[model samples]
Target: MKNIIENLKEYALETIEAEAEAVSQLPGIVDDGFGEAVALMARCKGRIVVSGVGKSAVIAQKMVATLNSTGTCALFMHSADAVHGDLGMIGPGDIVLFISKSGNTEEVKRLLPFVKKMGNPVVSIVSNRDSFLGTHSDRLIYVPMEREACPNNLAPTTSTTLHLVVCDAIAMALSRFKNFTAEDFGRFHPGGSLGKRLYMRVEDVFDKTNQPRVSEDETIKNVLITISSHRLGATVVLGPDGDLRGIITNGDVRRMVENGKDINTLQAKDIMSRSPKTVDKSALAVDALRMMEANNITSVVVLDGGKYAGLIHIHDIMREGIQ
Candidate 1:
């Protein structure tokens, strides 16, 4: 058992070293050909139809997803399925991109003739530029590799990594060329935590109906009742004509009690904090969270056009997974 465990570590290290070495050679392959391929896709008026077989087919789907998410339109067509009937998804202006380790897969070879018959421009990522798929392509992005990470040089390990990296490079290049911004990314991914951080405003997350406030001359007993009833841990003190005055929190009440102050003799104005942290209702929720974290407070006053609208608690931001 010890012998097997020791050999496992050695084999794993060898695999990693071999794959890293192959990846190190990828930069040299990104020459004029790579740029041309990216430019061709950028100029394409329609979606990028990426097709492959076996492990390459899985990588092709991932490429399609990345391209679509990064502002480039793309579709995945399995080479085996394309020949069977999926070729109908290809449009006239669409560009056909083929991924292959050998560039000579029988399924892709069979599918290529039909793609050519449709008069679509063909782009290929392949290790062997002389193979059928590479030789026949209109644009070629060559990815040369020493060997697979597989001990027998059969599994699609290092080669697939090279293919995926090349696809990502192409997607990122196109994204930059199109000037795709974080706002655009947020639009594409609206349901995730990342999207919420980028676009969710304080108005969207804070409770609107829970605007707990009290008059400055109100008794301290009522201020405690307001804070307790609203369950916000704090209350805003407003003056006549609804102008902002001050704020009182549970901590203030605790301190007053500890100091043995005459609770009955005081009003809201006497015990309230003169200044409190606040955020604009239109500001991003993530920004509000930052303010809360920086101030070491659990809530902040939400202002709408300089008027107190509501309170945004740290719990509210946390509930939305905006952190």
Candidate 2:
């Protein structure tokens, strides 16, 4: 058992080192061809049709997703399927990007002729520049590798990593060329937590129906009731003319009791914290979270146009998966 564990660890370390070495060689591979491929894709009038066979096909799908998310229109078509009716998905204005390690896969070889006859620009990420796919491509992004990370050197291990990295590089280059901003990314990823953080404001998360408040002269029992009813752990204290005054929390009640003070004789203003943390209702929810974290508080008073609005709690922000 000990020998088996030791061998597994050694093999893992060797695989990591081999892949890292192969990836380090990529900087030298980024010549004028890579730049030309980026420019071609950036200027493409239609979607980028990324196609590959075997493990390269999987990387091609990931490339499509990255491109679409980063402001580029892209789609994936399996090289094997492209020989069938799937070839119709490629439009006249689209660019075809083929990924392969040996540059001579049977499916890629079969599909290359059809893609070339369609008059679409062909870009390839290949290791063997002399092979069929590499020689037929209009622009070749060569990824020269020594061997795979597999012990038998048969599996698509290091080569796929190189392919994925190159695809990511191309996507980022196109993204930068188009000046894609985070706001644009947020538009693309509106349903995820990332989009919520980028666009969700305090008004979106704060409860408008549960604005707990109490008069400054209200009894401690009524203040406690307001805080308990709202379930926000705190309540705002309003002045005589309904102006913002201070805040009272369950902790304040507990401290008042712990001090052996007569809680029944005290009013809301007597035990409330005069200086409370506050946030504008129009502010971002992430900013509210930052305020809560910095002050070590669980909630903050929400103000709308310099007037008392409501309370925003940490759990409210957390419930929406906004850090």
Q: Model 1: clashing residue pairs? A: none
Candidate 1 Cα lDDT to native: 0.93
Looking at model 2, residue 108 earns an lDDT score of 93
178-204, model 1: which lDDT tens digit per residue?
A: 999998988888899998898999999
> Compared with the true structure, what per-residue lDDT tens digits does model 2 show for residues 224-292?
888999999999999888788899988999999999999789999899899999999989899999999
Which regions of candidate 2 deviate over 4 angstroms?
Answer: none
Deviation of model 2 at 109, angstroms: 1.3
Cα lDDT computed for each candidate against the true fold: 0.93, 0.93
lDDT score of residue 98 within candidate 2:
95
The candidate that achieves the highest TM-score relative to the unseen native structure: 2
Cα RMSD (angstroms) for every candidate in the order listed: 1.6, 1.3
lDDT (0-100) at residue 262 of candidate 2?
92
Clashes found in each candidate (C-alpha, N, C closer than 3 A): 0, 0
